[model samples]
Target: MQQQAPKAYIIVSNDKNEIQKTSAYTAKTLSSIIKTCLGPRAMQKMVLTKINSIEMSNDGNSILREMDVNHPSARCLIELSRTQDEECGDGTTSVLIFASELLNQIVPHLKTLHPIKVCNILRKAKDICINHLNTIAMEAAESDLINIVTSSVATKLCCVLKLPIPELALRSVQLIKSSIDGRIDVKNDIKIEKILGNFDECEIIEGIILEKEIIHSQMRRSIENPKILILDMPLEYRKGESVTNMEFSNKNDFTRALEIEEEQIHKMCGYIVDTGADIVITEKGISDLALSILYEKQITAIRRIKKSDSNRISKATGATVLNRLEDASPKHLGEAGMFEYVKIGKEYFCKLSKCKNPKAISVILRGPTRDVLTEIERNFMDAVKVARNVLLNPKLVPGGGASEMSMALKLNNSNDKEEKIIFRECGVALKVIPSILSTNSGNGICLDVINELEKKQNKDGPYFGINGITGEISDMKNIVLEPLVVKTQCIKSGFEAVMQILRVDGIIESKSK
Candidate 1:
């Protein structure tokens, strides 16, 4: 008997309704492949690239992006991941997981409808979903800032650990917010005095003080009256006379002029010392002769006064720098005179007399190792970025499990005439509600049991409501019943993913004939 070749399965339809088949099993197999990594207990994956390897997180977006999916639909999921990342910065996994599940739910219904009909329904559902989400979003309260912050942090922790300490999470949020609020820009040549042990003892001080060892052997161990000089100009002296082109006839004339210039620089320094100024702050560098005179007189000096720093110090201290060093004296120190220095850990804190703030806030992060510190820093920065957004926006809906439920329920009840076909094809789509509920319950039960044991073992508080919801618990609990939001986001994500996946359908090709 002659052998018969098997028929190819078509996965995509062209604009002219022509079916282009690849493999019939590809979409189904791809869907099942990602389903295993869906939930909280999902493991991490390590992906190696040409340059380096990235640690694989069970995060939906991360796993999808890391994988080399060849099928058209699977590739669409990757674009969906990118869209989620760009829009929310966080919800990448949720977008993909829900999207994959949505496709899975649609495949059976797709068997009954034309592919074009399925695509049309998807577009309509997307619009309905977006509208429903906007309505739910408006229901979010702007007054509940703390609840919003708590919810955001809890969501972050949920992705990292099944059972996270809510109180600790809240405390971390507060610390971050407080640190941002207390950030101070140090102005002037101030001292950072460390009061020994930790950051809590650090203080900021004004005025310049050099800790260098005294070079003069006979300089009174500590002069009772230390003369201070504040010069905001360069120590270099200009020629006494401006020589015209005719005046510069020979090198000898220039040499004598240079000598006289050197003498004037020495006289300037002598005058500064004579006026009892011990330290000088200048906007420019000091001449060699002037430096030598100050060194001989045991007068310490620092140059380079940044304009901003100078302005800030002037505003705070009520003292102006005299143009001529001869005029600078101790009497001109004004309110800026007092400064205290203390050593703390690796850095010094200089507390200026002018700053009247009661206390300085410092955030001390504790990590097991340097890498842990780096991770913590990265997480902190991410949180900070979100925090700023929340502060500016000040309105937020529920998140984590609650957010998932809200989206699901919103999609279910959404009523758009255009979306009727989608709802009809999927037939309320709530047939899978029981299964989702069952899975949600199962996941919750396992988490609850673990949390209960943890509470008993650790004697900590109850696990439920560890992080409170933005609105009433009832609202979040009824999320699955409100499928509009979930349906909308999912459909939108699906359409986008589908388009992107189709665009790159032939991305990988077989080289051999």
Candidate 2:
């Protein structure tokens, strides 16, 4: 019998050409996967997770997040989108698109030029393009902020819900900005609460809203100018340790023990009542006996509240969270102008409002269904982030690819020939934004629209691009605007990702036995 050749247990390939080919293919493939999910007219991708749940979204970061790709290059691109979202929060899709196109642009030139040379050229081009973008960027005014928010929200929401959503988002961001003492942190300060209801009924509350009800049925549901008490300790009777045991010789002995427990709980409730707290919120449980005492005193008690919610309530109402009943005092109490138990959907929520100084606020997001509400929340979050970015940076760029196209044109016109070739490719890569926008519009005149945009920018001197909705060339200055930080991050992050992918030289695989 012929000797059978042993199967290759491990394979290693250091072929530079094959590795570069793989990287390019992976980047382009990943790009094409989300290409249709780019613009206002983009298509939505329905991702079915391993746990068998479905997520339908057009947001690039969301789509890539749910994908379970094993390819290294694909993961890098996905991580790039995540980083963009974390840093800028609004240009996740644009960064990925630009990065892929940049790779696509420079891949062909790799055979003629060194990878390090290409990387350096692209790096220099990125800096120059960004500086040019900065020169063209205009400062954002108060009204212009709403426009920027509207532009971002308009892409994800329907026309009917567009107008009000941005208003709510900007208002929430402003509330967070104004309330904070030193720093403005939108992510932690703003709380988004979603309830199933009419979408048009969405509103922002000036204080926290907890999805919890009063512990006792007889407790008051509404109070005016209530003093609040927040607790970190349990109001229930303490339990004996596992190592300790108690034996009762008679049933009356056990009854005496129960009475002592009730008396202890009553004394704890008396501490709160003495503090003149109209409402009590605890991070731990409250026993039935304690609830009865609070109810008799007409105090509304919310038990088992989340720690984060308790902290926010403290911030909103100027209350101090106490770990012991002995530490309760009038000075430790917080005051709210109004406290009410509101029934939303099939559940009851505790609403605290009209605080004198509230550093945290709740945005109530309502929709006809869970999926709709989820999508709205996702889109609203991006809008909030966009508003925050603008408030922090206060700079604006013409949206709908005008800024990108202008950067592309300027990058191409650089004086040095060697640098000119690199800039030309970079410029062409930047044009992918408008080209994809045109393609997704289904106008069937992508090339025509691109040429028209270039002509308009060349003639009108920037601030001219295709209107994503109408698929026609228009003055983007009056039509739409995006934050300068978002655009700047897109080019910087995209180029970095392309450089990472292009620098890969080989892959070594070892199969497990």
Candidate 3:
């Protein structure tokens, strides 16, 4: 017998059931892969890259970016998650989960109303949800922010950052906070570097780490109150761009030529030292002779530093990277309280410490395996980003799905004021969060537990959500909480994604030209 033809793509075409099934399958398809990476009990996904490399990560954003998702709806959800990760850092999974659930609920209602009408109603309901988020969110202290980050990191399916992650994250915020109105610039200020070692060994250094070694062994490995100079030129003989040939009539001429070159090298070193720069960072090579000369002068010189690193030093130390040494002066040098070469594993890193004020800092991550460290770094970033977002907004909301359930309770119970067409389904769909949390944690979602959360919706309970691990209703704020922005953005982005996909009436395929 021959293989039967495919089942005629029941939901792939345009219809009410089509929208519902396709959206549900797409959402479920995407969520099923990473939902296990949800709470503290989440699991890691070992994804195979196109190059045949295996990546074990629990980061939702990472998985979303790397996964081979083909459906338009799925890609929309993935992009929504990316925005969440970019703007907020954490909660990518939450946004996608909420979108999938919300779309899944809207699928059945497609038969009752036109997509345009449904979308219009959703926009209004979204405003209501956002207001609810802002109303319920409370201002949090620094300690509460740390707790939120720790809670987020601990639930990472890849590598739960134990203690070092939270400790280092808080320190990073503090260090990054030292600049400009004491605000943390997550993208620009905080930098992350990964190393091979135990994850627990990871720590946040107070300053930036440049992956460079001294140009000469004779140079001191440590310097205090180091004045730093950034150079973009080579100290070697300036062989003009075009080659030059010369004939010496006698050996004296050759000797004089060699002496002149040595004199130039010495003169360059003198000018550098004259600037009172204890550390000279060059973008180009430093000749052996120049290195020896600098070593004798007790100046710590690092050569062949990448352009990016040089710029970071400039930003961190207020040093100007001069193209010509003749332009150098005391004013051009940057000040660092301390500078030292730190040995981690087999590599030596230049550590810049003790700046009066630094606009940039670095976060160093260590792990036993490269694969594990890769994921750990991603999770570390997720935590760091969330921490930074909290600082910008500093408003906290109960996590563990309490916020969504509360939103649903209010919307579902709304009486007489607004139409129930679109808002009603969203209210019903909001429970997807806690329900999934309960199911993912291996606990059967008890209706009574959900009902209890809804029943207490009217009361002043900031801690109302299911304990995903135990399937019990408890104070979720103590175990897990999130930034108000994270909650608000999730709802806004999730519903908007659903509307975009739902409004697609059909896929028009043109004949290949």
lDDT winner: 2
What local distance difference test score does each model get? 0.44, 0.84, 0.78
Candidate 3 per-residue lDDT, tens place, 145-213, comes to 678888777777333445467667766776677444766667677667888877666776555798887
- Candidate 3 collision pairs: 197-367, 337-354
Supply the global lDDT for candidate 2. 0.84
Candidate with best TM-score: 2
Going through the candidates in the order shown, the clash numbers are: 39, 0, 2
For residues 270-303, what per-residue lDDT tens digits would candidate 1 score against the true structure?
Answer: 7777666545556677776676777787766555
Ranking by TM-score: 2, 3, 1
- State, as a TM-score between 0 and 1, how close model 1 is to the true structure: 0.46
For residues 154-199, write the lDDT of model 2, one tens digit per residue.
Answer: 6675433553878888888777775335456777777789899887
| Candidate 3 Cα deviation (angstroms), residue 325 | 2.4
By summed lDDT, the worst window of 10 consecutive residues in model 3 runs over: 6-15
